[model samples]
Target: MRLTGPAGLATRAVLAAAISGMVLAGSFAIVAVMAVAGGMILSAYGSDLLGFVRITPPQMFWPIVWLLCALGATGLFVRAIVRIIRTERAAFLERTTPLSETTMAETSYIDSSAERLARQVGIATPTVRIDSTATPLAYTTYRPDTSIINADRDETPVIVLSTGLIETLSQSELSAVLAHEIGHIANDDLRLISVLLMPLIAAETLTEDEGRTSNVFELCGHHLSFIALIGVGIFSRGRELAADRAAAVMTGEPAALAGALETLDESATPKPTADLRDHARSTNAINVLPTLGPANSGTGPRSTHPSLETRLEQLRSLARG
Candidate 1:
C-alpha cells in the first residue's frame, strides 16, 4: 500500500529528475532568448543612443553563457543548502539555550539514550540539543562533517527536543521520540528536504513573492510555488512514513511511539491567528508532528505531514506485526 525501499527511491528519483529537467530547460530557453534579444537591441541602437558601451555577442555565447549559468546555479544551490541549515539552527539556538549536562541530569540521560537510538537506527550519534519552546516538538537537521575536509567523517545530525516535550513524555515515550528523530538522520531527510525546497527558492527569487511584486511576477510565482509545494508535500509525507517504520523497527516499540503521538495530539488546538497558522504550515515539514490544526484535516498541496490517524495506523500495524 505504501512505497518504500528501492521502488520508492526509484519513483522519487524519476520524478525529481523530470521536474528539474523541465525547470532547467525552461530557464535556459528564457535566458538565451533574452540575452540574444538584448544583444541585438543594443547593437541596433548603440551608435545613436550610447557610443561608449559596445554591444556585441561574445564568441560561442550560447555555450559559454549556459555553462556559466549551470555552474553558478549549481554552486549557489549547494551553498544555499548549507546556509539554510546553519541559519535555521542559529535561529533556533537564539530562542533557546543548549541543554547542560552538568545541571540537567535527566536531559543527560536523554542525550545518552539518543546516542543509543541513533546507533540502533544506523547513524552516528547526532548532537542533542534542547529548546525552551512550550510546544511539544522534536526535529532533526544535518550537514556534512568538515573535520577532514575531503574525507567522509560520518557527519552527525542534530536532534532537538523542546523542554515541553521532555516534561510531557515518559522515559519510554521519550526514547520513542528519539528513535523517530534518529530515523530522520538515518534516512538523510534533511538533504532530501533541501532538494525539494530548491525550486521554491528559485521561484521566490524570480518573483519576490514574499515582498511586494508586480502582478505578472506574482502570478508566475504563485504557479511555481504551487507546483513546488505539491512536490514537497508528496515527498515529505513518504519520508514521515519511512521514518515511522524505521523508528518502529529500531525501538521494537511502535506502541510507545503511538502513545507519545497520541499524548502530543491532545495538545493540538485550533490555530486562531494567521501568524500561528503560517508558522504551523512552515514547520510541519520538519516537526515530528504536523501543526496545521489537525492531521488529515487539510487536503491537497498544503498538507506537509500525513495525518496523525494515518501515522498511528502505521504504527499500530507495525506493533501488531
Candidate 2:
C-alpha cells in the first residue's frame, strides 16, 4: 500500500511499534533470567536470613551457577538473533536496486536536462549519478558538501537514475523522471524515510543468525517485521506518487510524467504463482499485480504508485487546463 498521507503515517507507527516491541521483549527476558539466577545463587550459598539457611555441595553449587549463567546468555543471544532477522528483512524490502556502473555513462547524459529543470523550479543544481540496472528506478542521496545554494552550505543533493529507465523513456518522459527524483531531494523525503527506518534496520542487524532455528517466537517476530516492512513499502509508494505530482508541476508536462509511470508499470511483469507475487511485492520495487496492464489500471490503497490510469487521467486533466 502507498505509504503517503494518512496511510503512510499509520504504517510508520506500526513499524515503530514492531521495533520497540522487539527491544523491550529482549530486555525484559534478560532481566527476568538474571533475577532468577541471582535468587538461585543466593539460596545455594545459604545466604537466606529469615530463619534457617541450607548450604549445598560445592560441585552442585558451581554447576548450577554455570547453568544459570549459560541459560541467561543463551536467551539474550536468541533475542538478538530475532532482532537481526527482522531488520534485514525490512532493509531488503525497502532497498531500491542501484543502477549499474556500466550504464552510468549513458544515464548521465540527462544531467544537463536535470540541471535546467532544477533552475526552472528554483532549486540549486544537484549532482546526478546513473546506474546500469535493467530496472527503471531512480533515487536520491544527500551528502554534506561545501557548496552554497542561496548561502546554505550544509547538505548537497545527489540524484541517481538507472540506465534502464533512461533507455525506456523518451526525452520528454525522461525529463519528467528527473524532475520526480529532484522533487525527492527538494522535499527532503529521502532523509525522512531513512531516519524513520534506521531503528528497524538496526534491530534486523542485531537479530540475524545463520544457524539458529526458526522457533515459534522467532517466527512470530518475523511476521511482525514483515507487516512493518509492508507498512514501509506502502509509505514508499505514496512518496512515489507525490514525486510524480511534483515532477509534473516542475516540468509543466503532466503527460510526460504519466508516460513515465506507464513505462515503469509496463516493465514490472508478474511471475507465475501467488507466492511469487507475494515475494515480488515484498522484495521488488515494482508491484506486479495482474490488473496493471500497459495502458491503465487502478492502484489500490497499498500501491506505491497511483494506478497507471489514474496518473494518466490526472495528466490529461492538467494538459487540458
- Give the Cα lDDT of each candidate: 0.64, 0.54
What is every candidate's alpha-carbon RMSD to the true fold? 5.1, 9.0
Estimate the TM-score for candidate 2. Answer: 0.57
Error of 2 at 250 (Å): 0.9
| Every model's TM-score | 0.74, 0.57
Q: Per-residue lDDT tens digits of candidate 2, residues 103-197?
A: 44444547678778777656778766554445555556543221211224335566656555678788888888788877766665655554434
* Backbone steric clashes in candidate 2, count: 20
Candidate 1: 10-residue stretch with minimal lDDT:
144-153
Compose the digit string of candidate 1's lDDT tens values, residues 1-321.
121443585576457546644654554454455555555555556444544565455556545555665566556655654565445445544544556642554776787887787666556777877776667768875432332112243666567787768888888888888888777767667666756655554555456535555775466555665566667676777778888887788788999999998888786554335434223233556788875556433265546677778889989988888
Ten contiguous residues with the weakest lDDT in model 2: 144-153
lDDT of 1: 0.64
Q: Quick one: how many clashes does candidate 1 have? A: 0
Error of 1 at 6 (Å): 7.4
For candidate 2, what is the lDDT?
0.54
Record all residue pairs in model 1 with backbone atoms less than 3 Å apart, i.e. clashing. Answer: none
